[model samples]
Target: MLTPYNLPQDMCMKSHFIFLTLICPGPKDPGKKIDIYLQPLIEEMEELWAIGTPTYDVSTDQMFVMKVAIIWTISDFHAYDMLSGWSTHDLMGCPICMEKSGANWLTFSGKLSYFDCHRKFLPPKH
Candidate 1:
């Protein structure tokens, strides 16, 4: 089942930008990619996203936008992509974006990355 997972301890408890392997967008279920990467990741446990309380990272030797990311998932979300299953439309979004999955899943490479600041200060990815 698709459920909301915490961003990370460092993120929820503190502010930090966690690094994650960039997963390629797909139209179909991308099976076991762990064997193909440096991390042991599964289709259900691979994504790069941030949630509550903004996390931060070093930029020019200083902290930048605080954020956390998808380092591991406990379940598969491909089910959400299936028609009539649970498309991204079902996913929640921050009013800051003025939309839901309506906008788009946070991009791995972008300035305004998905960072919900509703209950916390999830900041935009840099």
Candidate 2:
């Protein structure tokens, strides 16, 4: 979990707000099987969203229902593919483009090349 974005920039990154929920010990990447490991976390998040948990506020010295929402996630591209169920390989590697990606298969190197494909997203004046 992370701190709310409304907090000061410095406070947002503080250790207090950063909660480490789970850690998967592995010598190899989980790949597409990550959902199996995340099932428990997903269920808990769903419960939190639907029916909040009771929490005590230190500053206010009062009790209230606390609900959690996942606003954003940070991960490498490979892990992103695993979490999102998106294939980050071959010509359609670009998640934004999907089928309309500007990737080209290089016959000489036998690889999918994404050179200059990101130019389409640049500002017109850039």
What candidate 2 gets wrong by more than 4 Å, as runs, is 4-10, 57-62, 119-126
**What would the TM-scores of all predictions be?**
0.20, 0.74
* Span of 10 residues, lowest total lDDT, candidate 1: 79-88
- Locate the minimum summed-lDDT window of 10 residues in model 2: 1-10
Query: What would the per-residue lDDT of candidate 2 be over residues 1-126, giving only the tens digit for each residue?
Result: 545664579898888877777677789877888777889989998999999999888879999998878988988779888888778887777677887888888989998888888788999889
lDDT for each candidate structure = 0.39, 0.82
Q: Number of backbone collisions per candidate, in order?
A: 11, 0
RMSD of each: 17.1, 3.0
Q: What is the Cα-based lDDT of residue 17 in candidate 1?
A: 44
Off by over 4 Å in 1: 1-15, 38-73, 77-126
TM match of model 1 to true structure: 0.20
